[model samples]
Target chain A: MDTTWSAIFTEMGWGMVTMVLNLLKVLIPLMVGIELLLHYKVVERIAPRLGWLCRLLGVGPKTIIPLLVGLLLGVTYGAGAIAEINRRTPLSKRDMALLGFFLFGCHGIIETTYLFWVAGASALFVSVLRLLIAVLVTAAAARFFRLAETRKE
Target chain B: MNAFTKVIVDGILRGLKTALMLLRVMIPVYLCVTVLKHTAFFGVLAGAAGPAMRIFGLPGDAVVPVVTGIFTDEYGIVAAMSGFAFDKAAITTIAMITLCFHSIPVETLVTRQIGMPAWKMTVYRLALAIATGVFTGWLAGWCF
Candidate 1:
């Protein structure tokens, strides 16, 4: 309410429209490519190599590319691809939560570098520490879930 | 439709639907933030959130980047910190928390798209960010 009519229209109207359009431009292709990947069986091939690692994290092998891609491409562009994987795969609730842990902490190498520069923080320290924490937390979660499973059994 | 054509159309439709779902969260929150930036509400918020910030050893003003980063992206925190002279400890502290938790509204929706509950995901990020920040802050305060 404190914002002037002009500010609201400019920031909310055209601004939001542009953001939505830009997001779609990246997301649509990623989503479509995910479908294409399924058709091509790309995920099936790569997923096998990630077997033990994925199990250690308690996530589906299908989550590997999205987690890796999220690290490299950043979460914004990777979100559609990740959501596509979740839709196609029968990942468990704990696996989804673990994926959330992996992606949220260590996403986007470039974004991290840029913010590191702006914040004048150490890149090695920030990125390495984050990756370490992600692995530890996800491993801990996986261990917790496995304990819960054993208890149920 | 052919199999290939079906894939294309279905993917496009699914993508569009996902984008729309995310936009529902982004648009209103973005507008609200734009409005808040122009009001005194932000200052009051910074003050209200300041005590919680000491665990990370950052000053009250660092709250700006933390909140901005939560709602937006790493770039948002970068932009907020551009004007400040926070030392390396504070900078690293802020970076850890924001790195874990940035882009909350939109990312929360995307996480929800993957079937994680939004509130739980948000809480996970926030709690982890703070715990990490506090630990790192304590470590940094000792080292530097």
Candidate 2:
């Protein structure tokens, strides 16, 4: 019983340390990059070009940074991007919620799909299904919100 | 050069602050999961959620990895599932569920920081994940 308790504590300690370290390693570099990009107005230049994606997700053009970051990176990193962007140029509540829904369902697509593929699952199947589900659900929610707004008006 | 240096410093500081905030969620959840794994409670949970696997057309054993994935992360799902022998369809179904739902506690906190309420985001993801899992199950069975 005592050994089991010690083992549990040890595992917890190690897990927390590793998790935090991993988060910092990726997050610090990512935050620096975003800051540099924003400082140079790179995001502004890129945001307009992603109009098609903005339309597809039914969000504003300014959301392209966070949306792409969240899709390619992971949820936590995406949230970082969202918060930073929101601080700079406020996103509508609707846009934030839509992004939350989309990313929470399917962030880190390539890495995740690749991991699963290496684990023996079909790469095409997992990646396609995950993206499809996230896109469909987010698009449906956006449509619902639009209809509700029109009804109110 | 001076402005660039300031931006770099600001970014690092912000990153550190955010990392600290995240640790507030990650540490406790990690401890809880570790403790749970050391007890019979983990297996009990697997058993309880086992029946629900049928909804996704997954086997009972898939619950172990699915539940682990929810509390932990994608790596946890793979690690837990290493002991099992799941078919292609089952693997795909499980992947669908975990992809949508993994790292629930930490990710929910991250979303909560960005103006979405924690409970609302959690519920939304859980519902969407289950729905996707079920759909993937049916689709996988038909296709593969």
Candidate 3:
């Protein structure tokens, strides 16, 4: 019994270390890159050009911030940005719903790409697949269900 | 300490702190996954998920997150994926579909916040995810 317990403990400990190290290797660099991009206002400049695309999915310009952040920082960071935006802007229920849907798949692009690449998959395929899915799912939700209707004024 | 040196020191310390915090969270997550795998809980989950998982050409284990992803998010699915030894194409396809539509809890909550029915959103997202997974997987298999 003791031996079994020790074996389990060891496996768990090793797995924990491996997971943590892997996550850090990806996260730290991505965070720094995102910070630099934001500092340069590069994302902001690019947001407008993507405006037509965003509109097709029924989200306003302001929604781009969280999407960009989420795409770089992962879900928690995206949620944090959305919460902050909600606090500051009083986004309607519709917008928040849309934001939530958008974030469902959001993760740092380079980070996820790298992770997938390391896992022996195609990074470009993963990145493009994620983006396409988010757009299609969000659009379908908005159109077929009219989920935006319940937005509180 | 000179000003430039002090700034660099501060930045390094901040990075270290962040790294430590991430370690704290990741440790528990890894343990949970490992334990789930060893205890055969994952197998049971896979078995239960057999029906839904079939659509994605995944074993029953694939169902746990495909179903859970409906409630939680893609992270849960990704976490689940960490336990498997899937081939590159399979992994890409799985990740693609999961990323496309996973997270039942968040989705349900958001839809409810907007006054949409939670049940409806749940069904729709699951169906969409399954459809996308099937199409993508088939396409990937054909190409590869």
The most accurate candidate by TM-score is: 2
Pairs with steric clashes in candidate 1: none
> What ranges in model 3 sit over 4 Å off?
A1-14, A80-101, A105-108, A137-153, B1-19, B39-45, B64-79, B100-127
Fnat per candidate, as a fraction, reads 0.67, 0.71, 0.24
1 or 2, which is superior by TM-score? 2
State the C-alpha lDDT per candidate.
0.73, 0.76, 0.63
Query: Whose DockQ is higher: candidate 1's or candidate 3's?
Result: 1
For each candidate, the DockQ is 0.39, 0.43, 0.29
Highest lDDT: which candidate? 2
Give lDDT tens digits, candidate 3, residues B4-93. Answer: 455455554554676676555444554566567667677777677787666666666555445444544444555555655677667767
- lDDT tens digits, residues A29-115, model 1? 756876786677664566568778787777776678777667655786567666777677766677677878887767776546544
What is the C-alpha lDDT profile of model 2 across A1-153, one tens digit per residue? 898888767766665665666667655766686678668877457767887877888988777888877786566667888889878888988988888888887887755776676566878877776787778888899999999999999
- The second chain of candidate 3 has a TM-score of 0.64
Q: Who is ahead in lDDT, 1 or 2?
A: 2
Question: Which pairs clash (backbone N, Cα, C closer than 3 Å) in model 3?
Answer: B46-B60, B46-B61, B69-B103, B70-B103, B70-B104, B71-B104, B71-B105, B72-B103
Q: Please say which candidate is ahead in DockQ: 1 or 2.
A: 2
